[model samples]
Target: MTQNCFDDGDEDDVPEWADRVMADVAREVRRRRKEMKWSAQDLADRCEAIGFPIPRNVIANMESGRRAVLPLVEVMVLAEALYTHPIRLIYPVGYVEEVQQLPLTYPVDTAQAMSWFAGLNEDFRADHRMLRHHVAHRTAVERAFFAVHSEERQRRAAESTVDDIEQAKALRTQADLAERTARAKAELYQVRSDIYADGDPLPDLPDELVDVDPPEGYERDTD
Candidate 1:
């Protein structure tokens, strides 16, 4: 005979793995609080300053895992109160080597797990081309931005130095930094072009760099 779906009575229940993950979160919160040398009351007060006002008793219960559910709002507020990224609180990178990501799955490497959570890592990146392109494109953008910014500061230092020897050194370094900046910007352009070819939304290039294309003779870094 066919069975009614509701007769099973398990469909509406929260999974056992969810509670385990919640307990992990609770433990991490307590660890961070202790590391900061703050009582539950102190954490509550900090939350109040941020206008979210989690009570001391509530925080204590949460840390004790008596609060079975943690709202995303509270996660964000607690992260702010603890002066850390929400990702770090959830994944505890550098504090743990692996994380149980799902009910039946084996633990995943902590760093890779965190990257997956952030949509920046995938087990089969080659099969998901946009995500792969995004990772490369993002790294190139950051490198180009920092290279240009560094060259700006170096140029300023070269112009302002009163000592002749220091000024010469600054100018030499600025010239080298400028070459690196050009190379980085060149790479960013090529990555961006590849992203566009893949039909993804155009990367949000910095306004100052929107017009800079790859230099005519420079080979873009493939990796």
Candidate 2:
């Protein structure tokens, strides 16, 4: 005799592993839905919006353990609606660690990891945007500093006064120090961008100088 949908089969009929996996999926679905404060009907609505129409009753059945077999398409659509990756629904415990361990040199691996990461944490995307902006602004400032200092150096070289020579030396020293500082910062920010914004392009920073804000009461050379 065929077992009904709600029937708990005899111990011999269903393998322990299958039961455990289904239960895990159901629990994960319920947990993520609750995290977003979405009701079963809300989830159904969202799935329908994404072109996979799951009814509210089916959602209730899945969460309540009445539904045992979850289709892959349903899992994918449900994950999309929940703003999470399908792996999170399947392997709630080890998905992040497993994805992190993948070799990122392969383009496919990198793409998959990024997609998973984006779905899991919205804040990561926001942080990446802010970091990119900071790097760009610093790069512009460093370029301006170099251009200004180079013009000043040429002007100082043309002056023959002893006072002018000493002042030129001081200016050169200051410019050298600032360049080193900016280079160090750019390198650090580049390393951070590589790790956190994997698969995204980072702003190209000027090679020569580091970025520095002018000190209070210090007048910028307008020439």
What tens-digit string does per-residue lDDT give for candidate 2 at 110-164?
2355555444455654666655555555655565556556655645654543687
* Candidate no. 2 TM-score: 0.39
Q: How far is candidate 1 from the true structure (C-alpha RMSD, Å)?
A: 7.7
TM-score of each: 0.73, 0.39
For model 2, state the Cα shift of residue 29 in Å. Answer: 0.8
Query: How high is the lDDT of residue 33 in model 1?
Result: 97
- Can you write out model 1's per-residue Cα lDDT over 1-223, one digit (the tens) per residue? 1111121234332365576567667778899999999999999999999999999999999988788788889989999999998888788877766765655555677777788787764466867888788889889988998998999999999999999999999999999999999999888888877776666776677866766655452343356
Candidate achieving the largest TM-score: 1
